[model samples]
Target: MGCCTQKCQQISTFTIAAILLGVGISMAILWNNIFINIRNKQLSVAHDTQGFKMWKETPIPMYMEFYLFNWTNANEFMNNKWPTKPNFQECGPYTYSEHHIREQLTFNENDTITYKTRKIWKFLPEKSKGKLDDKITTINTILASVADTVKDKNIIVQEGINFFIKEKSEPFILTRTAEEFLFKGYDDPFIELAHKLHIKGLDIPFDKFGWFYDRNNSVDYDGVLNMYSGVEDINKLGRMHSWNYKSQLDYYPGECGRVRGTSGELWYPPLDNEVLEVFSPDICGTVKIRKNGTILHYGIKGNKYVAAPEIFDYTEPQNQCYLPKGVHLDNGVRSVQKCKFNAPAYVSFPHFYSADPSYYAGITGMKPDPAEHHFYLALEPITGLPLKVHAALQVNILLQNVKGIDVLKNVKSTYFPMLWFKQTAELTEELSSLGKLLLIMPSAGTYTAYGMIAFGALLLTIGFYLMFKKGWKTIHDEEQLLNQQQTFN
Candidate 1:
C-alpha cells in the first residue's frame, strides 16, 4: 500500500512537470512573434530600409501617373544619365531606342492616329530584278545627257529613283537622273545649331559602346529621305527601316531586322539623289542636351526606388501614366531639362519623324513570364501631374505616313502612330536581359505574413516530449532497481 501511494505521487509529479514545460514553451514562442512584429512595424515608418521584400501572390495591373520635369532650375540636377546609361531611364539621342516598360494602359489624348505606312525590302518576292521599259529608257537618256554636263560626273547619285521604277508604275517621263541635279549638302540645319550648343559633337569611332549606335536604328530614325517628287516615289526607294514598305511595327532589332549601325550625326549616305529629299526635322530631344533623350524619375518624396505609387486608380479613365522603369533620382536617371511647350520650326516629313512618343515609356527589357512581371516592371516612381502609370499606353508606336510617296519626298507632318500593347510584356522582353536595380522597402506590417502558430506548436510539442520521456525513464529505472534489491533481500 505504501509503495503504491509513492508511485502515484511520482507519476503525478512527472505529468505536471511535462505539462508545465509544454505550456511555458508555447508562451515563449508566442512572445517572440509579438516582439518581431512590433520591431518590424517600427522599422517600416523610418526611411532606413532599402526595398520591398513582400511576396506578391497576385500583382494586379494598376493605372499610374507621372510628371515632367518643369522646374526651370532643373538643369543643375546632376546624374542626368543621357547616353551615359542608355537604357530607358537615362537620357540619350532620340532615335530607335526601345527600352523601358510598365504594366498599365495609358490612353493619351495627344496620341492621335494619322496616316502612315511602313516599307519593306523582301528577298525579291519575284525575280523582277532589272526591268527596263519606256520609263527606264527615257530615264537613262536623261541621265546620260545630264551626266555629260556635270563636272563631278561620278556624283550623279541616282539610286532610289531608277532602281524602283518598275514597268507598270514608272511615271515622271525621264526628265531627271543622278547626273542632272546640282548636288548640294544634306539639308541639316540642326547640325549647325548643334555646333552652336557646347554639347560635344557626337564623334564615335566605329561601333564603340556608349559612343556610337550599332547601326541599329531606322535609316529614317535620323530622318527618311524621298528623292522622287512622284506618287510612286516610295516604291523606288528602300524604306531603310524595316525590310521594305511594310513591317513598320517591327522597330526592334534582330527579329524583323536588327542590323548594326552608328549613332549620332551620321553623314549622308552618298546622296541617293534617288533620295529626292531627306525627312529631317529639328531633332526635338537634341537641343542643348534637351534634344538628348532623357532618363526619367518620379521618385516619391522619400521613396526613390519603390515602384511609383498609383498616379491614379485603374478603375476609371485617368490622366496618369507609368513612366519607364529604372527612372529614378538616384543611380543616374535624368529629367527633361527643357520641355518645348512650343513645337519647333521644321519641315513636315509627315511620314517617319515624330517627337510625340517622347511623352511616356511602356515597359521593355523584360521576359514574358507571368511570375516575372513584378521583378522586371516594379521599378516605378511617384509621378506628379501630366504623368501616369499605364501598361497599354496610347502613344505613337511609329511615326507613320512616311513610307512610299512620303519617303521619296521626305514629309514631316508629325505623324506619330500612337498605339497600345500589353505594357508589362513589352518591358519584360526588353529588360529581362538587363541588370536590375531593385529597392528593398521594409513593410511596417507584413501585409502578407503567415502566422507562426505551427512553429510554436512544434516547439511546444518537442519540449513536452523530452520531459515525459525523462520522467518515464526515471520511473522505470526505479522499478527495476527495487525488483533486484527485493531478490537480493
Candidate 2:
C-alpha cells in the first residue's frame, strides 16, 4: 500500500506539471494574439468607447498665439518715397485659450457621424506680450481689396470706384488698436458704402473688418462635417466623408477640391512611416505633412510630422492645381483669394519659413527660424493621438499697381506681411499618465505570461528530478535486498 501511494503521488505530480506547462503556453499565445488585438479594438473611436468620448469633446488645453507684423515704414511706402525694400517690425504674441466642442452629433447607419464644430477663444492677458489696445499701423485691407476687385472692370467703373476712394480720403495705411485688427474688428466706411451700393465684389458678410472677426464661438463658421465613427472600420476613424455636405469644394479644381483627410482633431491608428493629411477649414483645403523624425513626450515615444517643403511648390505637379489662374505666385506663397472672398490674401509659413527666398526679397525684418516658425505635429503611433501640435501660418496680402486707383498706381508690387498665428497643444501630465498606462498594460501582460511560462517549466523540471531520484532509490533498495539474500544463502 505504501508503494502504490508513492507511485500515485509521482504520477499526480507529473500530471499537474504537464497541465501547468500546457496552460502557460496557451495563455501566452492567447494574450499576445487574441487579447492584445481585442484591447486595441476597444481603443477605436467606436460609440461609447473612451476614444469616442475624448473625440466628442477635446480635453486637451489649446492656445492660439497671434504675432502681428507691424509695418514700420507704411507711410514712406504709401508716399512712394520708401527705400528699396519694405521694413516690418514683429509685434506681439497675443495669446488666447482655445476651446473646441463638437455639437449636434447625428450618428448615421453608414458608420458615419455628422457634426458641427464650435470654437471659443478667451484672451489671456497674462500670457500676451502686448496689450490689445496697443496701436498698430498696417495696410488698409478695405482699400487694397477694393482696388484688386475693380482692377479688371470697365475703365469707367474703375475710375468711378477710384473717385469714390479718393473722395472718401481712404488712407492706404490705417492705424488701429491690436484688438481692432484681430477679433474685435473695426468698422470701415468702404465696407458700409460697398454694402449700400450693392457692389458685387465688395459685398462681404461682416460689417466690421478683422482677421478673425465674427468667428469667435461661432458654429456656422466651420461648416458641417461628416466623418467616420470607426465602429465598422477602425482605419477610417476621423476620416472625412464630406465637408459642409459636399465631397468637393468649388474653390479649387482637380484633386485640390476633394474634401478629404482628418479634421486635425483625430487620426487613425497603426500609423506607419507615411504622409499624413490634415483638412484645415481655415485654409479651406488639405495640408500634407510627412514624418520628420521621432520625439519623446512624457517618456512615451511619438512620431513627429512636419509640413512638406512641396506644400506650396507650384512647380510640383500635385500643387499646380492650387495656383490661381493668371496669377504668377512664387513657390512659397499659396493664394487663398478664392477662399478669402477675393481679397488677394495668401498663406505661408510664419515669416515665410521654408518659403522661396523671393517671397521675402522685397521685405525686411523677416527672420524664419525652424524653432519658432515651423509647423509640426507629434503623435503617439499606437493610439494615433496627438502628443504635441504647433500649427503656424502667416497671412499676407499682395499689393500691386491697379489702373485708375491713385493710391496703388505707384505701389511696388509685393506680398505684404500681415499677421501669423501659432496654434499649440500638448498632452498634459494627467493625460500623459493615462497614455503611459495604456502602453504599459500590454507589456505588463506579456511579462506576466513569460513569468508563468518560466514558473511552469521550473515546476516540470523539479517534478521530473524528484520522480527520477525516487525511482533510483527504490531500485537501489531492491538490489541491496537481493545481495543480503545471496549472502544469507
Candidate 3:
C-alpha cells in the first residue's frame, strides 16, 4: 500500500509539472503570436476605445513657433545697383500655444469617421523672443503677386497693372509690425482695388494681408476629413479616406493629388513600413517621411522618421508631379501656388536646408542647419503614439522681374524667404510613465513565463530522481531478504 501510494504521488507530481511546463510554453507562444495582436486591436481607434477619445482631441500640449525672415537689406536691394542680392535676418520665434479639436464628428457604418479640424492659437509672450510690435521690412507681397499674375496677360493689362502700382506708389518693400506680418494683417490698397474691379485670376479671399490672416480660431479653414476608425481593420486607423469629400485634390496631378496619409495627429500601431505619410491641410498635400533611426525618449523606445531630401527633390521621377503647371522649380522648392490661390508661394525646409544652392543664390543670411530646420517625428512602434514632433516648414515667394512693371523690372528672380514655423509637441511625464510601464509589461510577461517553465522543469527532475532512488532502495531490500532466506535454508 505504501509503495502504491508513493507511486501515485510521483505520478501526480509529474502530471502537475508537465501541465505547468506546457502552460508556460503556451503562454509565451500566445504572447508573441496572438495576445500581442489582440492587444493592439483593442487599443486601435474604435468607437469606444481610448484611442478614439485621444484622437478626437489630443491631450498633449502643442506649440507653434514662428520664425520670420526679416528682410534686413530690403532698402539696400531696392536702391542699390541692379541685381543686388537681398539680405535677411532671422527674427522672432513668435511662440503660440496651439489647440486642436475634431468637431462635427459623424461616424459612418463603413468604419470611417468624418470630422472637421478646428485649430485655435494663443500667443505666448513669455515664450517669444521678439515682440509683436517690432517693425519688419519685407517684400510687398501684393505687388509681387499682382505682377506675377498679370505678366502673362495682354500688354495692355500689364501696362494698366504697372500704372496702378505707380499710381498707388506701392513701394517694392513694405514695412509692418511683426503682428501685422503674422495673424493680424495690414490693409493693402491693391486688395481693395482688386475687389472693387473684380480682377480675374486675382481674387483675394480676405480684406487684409498676413501670413495666417483670418486663420486663427477658424473652423472652416481646414476642410472636412474622413478617416478610418480602425473598427474593421486596425492597420488602417487614422488613414484619411478623403479631404472635403474628394479623394484627389485639384491642386496637383497624378499621385500627388491623391488624398492619402494620416492627419498628422496619430498613426496605426505596429508600424513596419519604412515610410510614414502625413497630410498637412496647411500645405494642402501629403508629406512622406522615411525612418531615419531609433530613439529612446523617457525610457521608451521609438522610431524616428524625418523628411528626407528626396521629398522636395523635383528632379526625381516620382516627384515630377509635384511641380506646378508651367513652372520650373529647383530640386529643393515645391510650388504650392495653385493651392495658395496663385500667390507664387513655395514650401521648403527652413533656411532652404537640403535645398539646391540656386534657391539661395540671390539671398544672404540663409544658414541652413539640420538641427533647427529638419522636420521629424518620433513614435512608439507598438502603440503608434508620438513621443516627439518637430514639424518645420519655410514659406517662400517667387520674386521675378515682370515686364512693364518698373518697380520689379530690375528685381532679381529669387525665391524670397518669408517665414518658417515649427510645430512641436512631446509626451508629458505622466504619459511617459504610462508608456514605460506598458513597454515593460511584455518583458515582464516573457520573464515570468520562462521562469515558470524553469521551475516546472526543476520540479520534474526532482520527481524523477526521487522515484528512481525509492525504487532502487526497494529492489535492494528485496534482494537482501532473498539472500538471508537462502542462508537460513
Candidate 4:
C-alpha cells in the first residue's frame, strides 16, 4: 500500500507540474496581449488632458522666411528686357520673421473646449533684404498713382474715393512701432472697396487689409484670435474650421477661400496613395494628393497625405473642396480672391504644385519645380501630432485693368508675384519625448512581451525534460540491477 501510494503521488505531481506549465505559458501570452492593449489605451489616454483632448498646452515657436519676388523689372517685359510677361520672376530670399504662437484652452460649460491662439510676430530687420523700411512708402505711392490716374480720367468720386484709401484725401502709410499687437483690419483701399461693394450687392474680391499693427496701438491681451473647431462627435477626431476673415464682404463658394483645413487633417495614419482633400466650407472639393510617400521627409517613412474628415459630408457645399476661385480649382493652386487675408494680395504654394499646367506653360521667366519648392510635413502617426511642418507660399498682387483708371487699363489682369514665404515649425525636446514614448516604447514593450513568452515556453520544456529524466533513468537502473541479480542466481 505504501509503494502504490508513492507511485500515485509521483504521477499526481507530474500531472500538476504539466498543468502548471501549460497555465504559465498560456497566462504569459494572455497577459502579454492584455498589457499591450492596456499600454495602447494608456497612450491614447495620455493625450486626453484636462481641457484639451489630444493636444498639449506647450508653446510652439514658428520661424518664417519670406522670399520676395523682385518686380523691379516687371515693366521691362514691355521693353523686351527678356521674354514673356515679367509679372513673376527671380523670386529671391528676402526676410525672416518669428512668431511665438501661444495657445490657451478653456473648457466650456457644454463639454466643449475653446481654443485660442495669440501670435506675437517679430520681424527680424537684420535678416531682411530689399526695401522692408520703404514698404509703407511704396504702397502709399502706388495708391496715389492709382488715385491720380483715376482722377485724370474723371471717374466717379464714389469709385475714386474707394479706389484710393485716404485718411484725409491723401494716401496714408501704415506703420507700427512694436512687433506684436492685437489683430486688426489694415487701412487698405482694397479691403474698404470690397466692403462697400458687398453692401452694394457686388461680390468683389478682397481681404482684411491692414498694417501689421493693432488698432489700439497698445497691445491688447484680451484681443484673442477667434477660431472655432468642430466637435460634434467626440468618438472621432475633430478638425479646426476655416478661419473667418473679419473683413469678409460676402461669402463666395466659388472662390474656395477657407484656410483652416487647407492641408487636410492634422492627424494621419493614412492609407497608401490616399487622396487627401482640403476642408473648405464654401467650395465642396478636394485638393489633389501631390505626393503620397513618406520619402519627402527623412527619418519618417510612415506618414502620407490622406483624405480629411470633411470628405464624408453628404451635402453639396460640404462634399467638395476646391483649390481656390481664380486659379484652376481642378488643381490645388491658392486663390486669394476669396481668402480675405489681412493683405490685399493673393497667396499660394510656391511653384503651384497642383496648379494647372498653363500657369507656367507660357511664362518664360517662371518655372514650377516641385523638388525645390514643395511643402514638406512629417507627422507622428500614433499621436497625430506634427513632428515637423514646413510650408512655402508665394504672395502676389492682382494687377487688373480698372475701367476708369488709365494707368491700369493697359496692364494685363494677372496675379503678379510679390513675395513667397517658407514657414517651419519643429517639435521641441519636451514634445519629442512624448513622441518617443508613443512610438518607441510601445514597440519595445511588444518585443519584451514576445521574449517573455519565448522564455516561458523554454522554461516549461526544461521542466518537462528534467521530470522525464528523473523518472525514466530511475526505472531503467532498477531493471538493469534486477536482470543482473537474476543472472547471478
Candidate 5:
C-alpha cells in the first residue's frame, strides 16, 4: 500500500511541473505575438494603385494651417533709402481647406514608386487686418510710365499683391522631376496689369525691366510637379514586395525645411546644442534642429518618445521656429538663388531664432521675440509622428543692384523680410488612444506573465515542501487512522 501511494504522489508532482512549464511557455509566446503585432501595425503600408501609402493615423488626413507674415512697413521699404530697415508683421493664420495625400506609387516590379503629392488651394477669401494701401501705392509707383493705363488698377488692387495672395492662388504640387516646387514670383498683378495695358494698345516694354525680364514667365502649373525627396535610401523612392514587411515609417523627408532629418522624427536627447539635421525641399537645403529643452520633458510615453503637456507645460516648442543657414547675401539669409531652381529672393525663419545679430540689430520697427516667433515640433519617438508641428519660414528679397529693375537699384543690399508663415498640427484624442493602447499592452503582458510564473512557482514549492515533509508518512497515518483519512483527503 505504501509503495503504490509513493508512485501515485510522484505522478502528481511530475504532472503539475509539466502543466506549469507549458503555461509559462504559452504566456511568453503570447507576449511576443502582442508586441510584434503592435510593431507591425506601426510599420504597416497598404499597397494601392498609387503605390505604398503611409501617413499619420491621427487627424485622418493631416491638417495644416499657414500663418502668413504680412509686411507692415512696405511703404518704408520701397520708399526709404537703400539699406532701409524692413518691418514684417504677423498676419492671417489662413487655414488651408486641402489635406495632404502622400503615396509611394509603384510603376514597376522594382517597386519604384513615383511619390506624387498634390494640394488644392481652397477658394476661401482671406481676411486682412489693416489696409495695405502702402504696399499697393509702392507697387504702382515702381511701375510708373511703363504701363500707364494699368497703374490705376494696380494702385486700387483690393487684395494685397504679395506672398499671401500668391499662396492663396498657387497650386501646391510635388513630383520627382520638379524635386521642389519653385514659386512663379508675384506675377499675377503684373499679368493683370499687362492685360489691361494691352486693351489700351500700349505695349508695355516688360523686357526692359530686369525684375520682369528675368522673372518666370511660364504659366504657373496647377498640377503637381515632379520632385525628389533627396533621400539616400533608394527604397524611400520605392520598394519591392520583400521590403513590404519592413518599416515604412520614413517614406520621405519632411517638407518643413531640412532640419527635420530623413527619419522625420524630431525627438532627440535632452541636451544643450543637440543639433539634428533634416531635409527641406522648400529651403532647397539641409536644416539643423536646435534643441531648447523648455518644449517638453523627454522620455518614453505610449510606447513612443513623446513630449506631452502632462509631462511638461505645453507641447514641444509651441509657436516657435528656428533660423536657417544664411546662404543668400549673408546675415543668415536663406537664398534660393544658389539652389537648382534659382529662386529670386531669400528665405529664412521668422523672428530669426539663430540669425546674425545684424539681422535684427539696429533695424527699426522689427520685433524678434524668440519666445513668440520660434518654431517647434512635438514628435512621438517610437512612431516618428509629430503630435504637434510648427514650421515658420520667412521670404525676403535680396535687394542690391539690378540694372533694368529700377526699383531694386535704390534699395540697398538687405535680406528684407517679405513674408513668413507658420505651419501647425496638433494631437487629437483618437491618436492618443492608439498610442496609449500600444503603451499599455507590453506592460500588462509582462506583469501578467510575471504573476503567473510566480504563482506557478509558489504552487510547485508548496507541493514539494509538503511531499518532502509529510511524504509517505502522512499516507501511512491516514491508512492506519481510517477516521482521519477522510479529514486528510
Candidate 6:
C-alpha cells in the first residue's frame, strides 16, 4: 500500500525500544539517586541520640576486660608508682571496698601458692571520701599481711577470716559462683555479683589445674578438631586463630560457653555511664556476657580526661580476667568518637570490582575472609588482633562506612558507642543509604517504591527487551526474507 508503511512500522518498533531503554536507564540512575535521597532521610551515621533506644536503664559496673600487656603494665604501675602498702597500712582510697579487700585476700591466698610467701594488706587512706572512712579498712592484692596499721582505720584482715562464710560449707569451694569471683576475689565489694554471672563454675580458675600444656599455654587439645583451635572463647578469652596472636582470654572460642543476644536482646544505654554515672570495670556488669561466654564489654571507656576501665579485671586470676590496662574496657561508651577509629582511606566501588588492597578489612571487625561480610570493624588497636568467636562480625568492615556498597549501610555506628560494644549495631540499619531509606511502615515503603521507580523502570526495560527480543528478530528476518524471495521470483 505504501513504501513508507513497513519502514515506518520498523522505525516505530526501534523508537519504542529505544524509548524503553532510555527510560529504563534514566530510571535506574534516578532510582539510584532517589534511593540515595530516600536513604539519607532514613540514614543516620552521625548518631542521633533521638533515634536510638535510649537506656533509661543504668547498667551496673561489673567485671572488666583487659589485655595481658595492659594487665602487667597497670599492675606494675600500681605496684611501682602507687607501690603496695608496707602492710595493710593503706589499701588506698575510693577504689577499695570490703569487696576489693576480699579479692585482695583471695588473690593473696592464691599467690601464696606461687610467691612462696604470705600476702598481707593494710588499707591506709590515700584520696576520696571512701578511703577517708575511719571505720573502713582497705586491702591490697599485692602486699603481704599488714598487721600494723594506722589507728584511724580498721585493720580488716582475713587471717582465717570468713572469706567463704557467705558460701555454704558443703560446697565451700563449689559455692563460689561466677558472680562471686567476678567481684575480683573471694572479696570483691560486689562479691554478690558471682551469682549474676551467666556461666557458673567459670570461676573454677581454668589455671587452677595448671597450664593445660604448661609449655604450650594452649588448653583443650580437642578444640583443634573444631574450626577454631585450642583457644578459649575468643569472646571471653580473646582471639586465638594462632598461638602468637592469641589474647590472654577470649570469649566464645569454640562455641564453648557461647551466648548470643537474641532478636530483642540487644541493649544500649543512652547516657554515658562514666560522664553521667559512676562505674568500675572491676565489677561484673561492665560487660554484657551472653550465656555462651561472649564477654561483650566496651571498646573504650571514659575519655582522655579519665583512664579506661581495666579490660582484664586483673584483681585475681580466678575471678578477674588478667588484661592489659591501656586495654581497658571500651565500655561505659562515652562517645562513639572515642570508640571508633577513622578509616585510613576510603575504598572505591563496585567493592566487587575493587582492586585496591588497603580497601581490605584490617583492624575493623571485618575479617580477612572474602566471602564473609560484616558491618563492624575489629582491630586489635594492632594487626590481626583476635576476636571472641562471635565477639565481632567474622568478616568485619569499617564500622561506619560513608562510602560502602552494603544495602544496610549506616554511617552512624549507633551500636558501637553503646554498652553492647560487642554486638551488631544495636540499631539495625535496614535498606537505608546512610541509615534513612527503607522503613517499617507502608507509607515509607510506598514512598520507597515510588522512589524505587527509577530502578523499576530499568527492570521493566530489561524485561521488555528480554521478552520481545525474539518477536522483533522474527519480524526483521521475515521482512528481509520476503523481499529477497520477491526479487528472486
Q: What is the C-alpha lDDT profile of model 5 across 1-489, one tens digit per residue?
A: 433566677667657766775676577678877784545444433343111233311233343333333444554543445434555455444444434554434334432233334333331335323222212111221232222223234433323323323544421110111001112123334445545545442343332222212223222211212222212222232112222222221221233222223323222222232344444544444455554443332233321221111211112242112222332223445445433122245555565545666666634445665644565655444444445566566665443433333343454444445445555555566756665566567778877777767767777776677777765444666677897777789
Most accurate candidate by lDDT: 3
Model 1, range 85-158, lDDT digits (tens) per residue?
Answer: 11112111111112211112222233211112221112111322221110111112111222122212232232
Worst 10 residues of 1 by lDDT: 50-59
Better candidate number, 4 or 6, judged by lDDT? 4
Residue-pair clashes per prediction, in order, are 101, 0, 0, 8, 25, 92
Q: Give a tens-digit lDDT track for model 2, residues 1-489.
A: 434355666676677777776777777777665654664566666677888778878999999999988888777766667558888988899999999998989999998999998999999999999999988988899888888888888889888888887788878888898999999999888888888888886657889999999999998888899998877787887899998888899889999989888887787774675788899888889998898999998898999999977898888999999999877877888888888877889999999998989889889999999899988899898778789999999999988788688777777888999999999999998989988888777677777777777877887788788776764244457778999999999
Per-model TM-score versus the true fold = 0.22, 0.90, 0.88, 0.61, 0.58, 0.22
Residue 459 C-alpha lDDT in model 6:
54
Worst 10 residues of 2 by lDDT: 1-10
Off by over 4 Å in 4: 1-54, 57-61, 74-84, 87-104, 108-112, 124-235, 241-268, 271-273, 277-291, 296-300, 304-334, 341-345, 351-367, 427-434, 471-489
Off by over 4 Å in 3: 1-25, 77-83, 270-272, 454-489
C-alpha-based local distance difference test score of model 2 = 0.85
Best by TM-score: 2
- Local error of candidate 6 at residue 24 (angstroms): 4.7
lDDT ranking from best candidate downward: 3, 2, 4, 5, 6, 1
For 68-119, candidate 6 gives per-residue lDDT tens digits of 0001112322232422211111111222111011111111111110001111
User: Candidate 1, 406: how far from true, in Å?
Assistant: 16
The models' CA-based lDDT, in order, is 0.23, 0.85, 0.86, 0.43, 0.41, 0.23
Candidate 4, residues 61-135, lDDT tens digits: the string is 666665544444444443433335543445334444454332555544433334444445555667655434332
Give stretches of model 2 more than 4 Å off. 1-19, 33-39, 77-83, 201-203, 464-489
- TM-score leaderboard ranking: 2, 3, 4, 5, 1, 6
